[model samples]
Target: MISEKNKSNRAKQQTNHTAGRTSFVRLRQIRSESDEHLIDFFKEVRWSKKKGKFVTPATEEKHNEMVAKYSKLEPEKQTKDVVASIFREVLGHRPGYARGLGEMVIPESSRQNTVEKFAALTERAERHEKDAEYYKNQLEELGGNVEKVLAKQAEYDKLLSSYMESQRQTQGESHRETQGPA
Candidate 1:
């Protein structure tokens, strides 16, 4: 026969294991639901918004045309903004909002669109890097110019010092001459 303490310990262990399993299942279910929502949103954006243009269309003119077309659609038909607003609303419900850098909630319809938008943002960022490189080169050119100016100023300073010393010596000689036999 087992002691009461042993039985209690075994019961506790079992409870812990069961609790762990339950938590794991809950997490898995949440992830799956999130994924399903994302895929649905992606499909909506791909087929309904851009007419199945998986990648964003070229040129701002084309993009604006697509956005205008998307905006004209009904709420149920709206892919980006509606979904984004819904996602924002859900994220607002999270307690972490009070703290800085909280995790955002993804609306079922906006998740995929958000992901694709992220990709677009990254592409735009790369373009900005080209601009950054241009600025960097400009900075280097300016630095070279500043160095040249400093060197010229140093040369002028040396010349000014030598001229002042000669003037001092001439004044001393004239003082001696004026004294006459001093």
Candidate 2:
């Protein structure tokens, strides 16, 4: 027979596990719905081989021209806006938008700044990790208490690991932002 405490813990664990799976399933459903909308939007547009871009029907003439040009080709042959839309929508990129005389563009500068910041942060993290190692070695050479030195080294290791993991997660998020829904 299980104790009341054990039963409660098991119930709590099962509830947490179920909640996680439920949230994951909900997220998947939302993504699927979003993908369907994107597909439908893309289907209404036509690709221009000559212009080498996906062309939405801004005008009837443009639409007719695109239809005539790409009708012979398969849908696979048509230039898909999946990548472009990903950049525009998910990554918040606006290729067509420009400031007066191109003095400043928010999207372009934002992307560049983000990349630069990430690079700087990664470099700083690497430097800090090296510095931590040097300090650990110096403490050992100076005959510091072994347990204290080891504990400090462990903390440094944990910090570096967390920093690297965060960096990886940031990179993954940016990569995903530039990728179309899947």
Candidate 3:
């Protein structure tokens, strides 16, 4: 049988260990909360878990091309929504786990607050319709410029054809006149 004194000493040791773990956890939580890169770290890890979703050089190039091609589009494309969507798709339906350090449960109020904030963002996006229309008009003007260039080219083609035909006729008439009424 273990002696009472030894048992008490073990209990004391366990208590110290528990206190150490508790303080460590609190410090970690504070660090995570205050670290600006925490969200970025989470996002990077989550998306990188998917093979092709992570940004590669080729993907970056393609994104740049798309951005350039659609430069006139209103409401700049933000990767935040895409990254958040990835997280939701991956984790939103997963079972809740709050047992240990790894398990995290977002409070219902916090979730509701996030939803409200996103709702406001959606409203702001809706309000940007006029700006989007303006961009569409700019795109239409570029198309119109292309059409004008095509029309001008066609007009020049017709003028050249007429001028060539007139020249040919004048040369023939001059040759015939020089032949002295052949």
Candidate 4:
């Protein structure tokens, strides 16, 4: 029931769409290539034909966490590949979507490594805050006088150095001390 002119126009449109679009890679291909640990990730993404959307069972916090973790994975891990595929699968090759997905996933490092580094950094920051609080309390206790605080600090440093000096006896001094009044 279509005219040749309309059919030609449709073909032209299809060609244009196909030219610009990168369809989602099939899941079978992804499964074969993906690591065993990512099986949980696979289970998280599902398509809903009736709703025409993905049925991710993640709460907002969980989804954001997953995005963060996935972003930090190496480019070679097929993480982005899986993300792109799922993205296109759910959203389709949307018209004019050529931004390259560059900053969407910020790569910090491998997840375990990044997490450990983050933990260490966080612990350091907490320790620094505690030290700052202690120093602030000490300064306040010095009656808000900068000179007094500096003097106290200098006194503490002198005392600490004196203790250190006593602990480190020269060989000659030790020998003289042991020989005593000879």
Q: What is residue 86's positional error in candidate 3, in angstroms?
A: 33
> Candidate 3: where is the Cα deviation over 4 Å?
1-108, 127-131, 179-182
Error of 1 at 140 (Å): 1.3
- Give the per-residue lDDT digits (tens) of candidate 3, residues 1-182: 56988897665521121123344335446656553232243323323343545334433343344344334445555354443343344323345532122235443356788899999999999879878999999999999999999999999999999999999999999999999974
Per-residue C-alpha lDDT of model 2 across residues 1-182, encoded as one tens digit per residue:
46988887665431111122334334334555554332233323234445654443332343344345545566785554533343234323445442111213334346788899999999999999999999999988777577778999999999999999999999999999899588
Which regions of candidate 2 deviate over 4 angstroms?
A: 1-109, 144-182
TM-score of 2: 0.22
Between candidates 1 and 2, name the one with more favorable TM-score: 1
TM-score for all models, in order of appearance: 0.39, 0.22, 0.35, 0.23
- Model 4: weakest 10-residue lDDT segment is 14-23
Question: Clash number for every model?
Answer: 0, 0, 0, 0
Model 3 earns a TM-score of 0.35
Q: Which ten residues in a row have the lowest lDDT in candidate 2?
A: 13-22
Whole-model lDDT per candidate: 0.52, 0.51, 0.53, 0.52
As a TM-score, model 1 comes out at 0.39
Tens digits of per-residue lDDT, candidate 4, 1-182, equal: 56988887665531121112323223334554655333233323333445554444332333454456656667786565676554444333544341222123333347798889999999999999999999989978776688788899999999999888876766668888999978
